[model samples]
Target: MGCALSGPGVTPEPTFSKEKRGLDLSEETECAETPEPLHLSEPQKALIRESWKILHKDIARVGVIVFVRLFETHPECKDVFFQFRDIDDLQQLKMSKELQAHSLRVMSFIEKSVARLDQVEKLEHLAFELGRSHFRYKAPPKYYEYIGAQFIQAVQPILKEHWTPEVEKAWESLFKYLTATMRRGFYTEEKTAGSGGKSPCSRKAGAGSTPNKI
Candidate 1:
């Protein structure tokens, strides 16, 4: 729904060469508050959505490569995803339908989130639901930042000259909101469970997962 699941598009690769190994995406700042929803100006949302449209052209390549690069950057977290764990070969895993299917699901979430940016209530609800689902699967907060970073890297090439300061800021802001909301969901459930309440994700499997649309 988000991106076509076809061969890698012919977009020129971004210049994320070895020189960017020490890429400090953290340098991009954000709102300091935690439990708050991510705030964005209309212009920022426009820039982010427009940028995504450009990258969406090759979301299959971008999504799969994000997983590859993420594992490259943080291999310790590989086992978290059942589809990725126990793979003797990285290249083979990247091409697997399992990975592609999972990637499409993630892309779908991004597509939905971007499309609803103008509707704060809808966007926040969507984000909270996603965070709530993933929290059940034991995804830590850092995964958001790392995965988002890989995504940014994947799309940087297609963004090219249009990836301006405002665009970068917009992405950083949106990503930060995603991470914060997810963390919020994780902790909220933890608090609920601690107080002997039935957390929505207590069902064990598919508790905090994206809906079965992929």
Candidate 2:
């Protein structure tokens, strides 16, 4: 259940602007007008629960194996991996074995976290923090898409024999939920700052702006 590898922290300086504040307010208003309930179909919830049971039954071994396989396939993503100590660094590097190890560790942490997917609030926060981490690393948002795809690719093979159409649907549903939740967190933070209270964007904007290490 522990992370397999650890890397430096990558925290990005938040950005904000008075001019952009209006835009943020508009966005917040739109979001407020929208009704976004965590509405999952019964089948979707069942699938996620079943997958959790299967994965959690052997979380440590499965998580490590998934990480190892993913790194083996996408060796280039190593640079995005952050060490625990360097979590706040924003510098990017060429792909390397060290990066690969770090990537695996991040995956390990994610897998362990995913086992607790039933806790919607915690999972949402984890996704947001992860998004922030990715931003800190200067990784393109497409990397999140890549991670999702590669994760399914790496896991499906092992899961295929035992996997059902329901399981596939469940994973797809889960991914969508996680992605939306993360994006919502980002938007909400932006909206909050636009309304005048302190925000990461605002904090990074002023002279006293300081990044938070994850």
- Could you say which candidate leads in lDDT? 1
- In model 2, how large is the Cα lDDT of residue 16? 34
Instruction: Find the candidate with the highest TM-score and give its number.
Output: 1
Error of 1 at 110 (Å): 0.8
Which pairs of residues collide in candidate 1? 133-208, 134-208
The TM-score values for the models, in the order shown, are 0.72, 0.50
Location of the lowest summed lDDT over 10 successive residues in candidate 2: 1-10
lDDT of each: 0.61, 0.45
Summarize candidate 2's per-residue lDDT along 134-207 as a digit string, tens digits: 43353433234444544555566566566776676556545644444444344445455466755434322112
Residue 20 alpha-carbon offset, candidate 2, angstroms: 25
lDDT comparing candidate 1 with the true structure: 0.61
lDDT of 2: 0.45
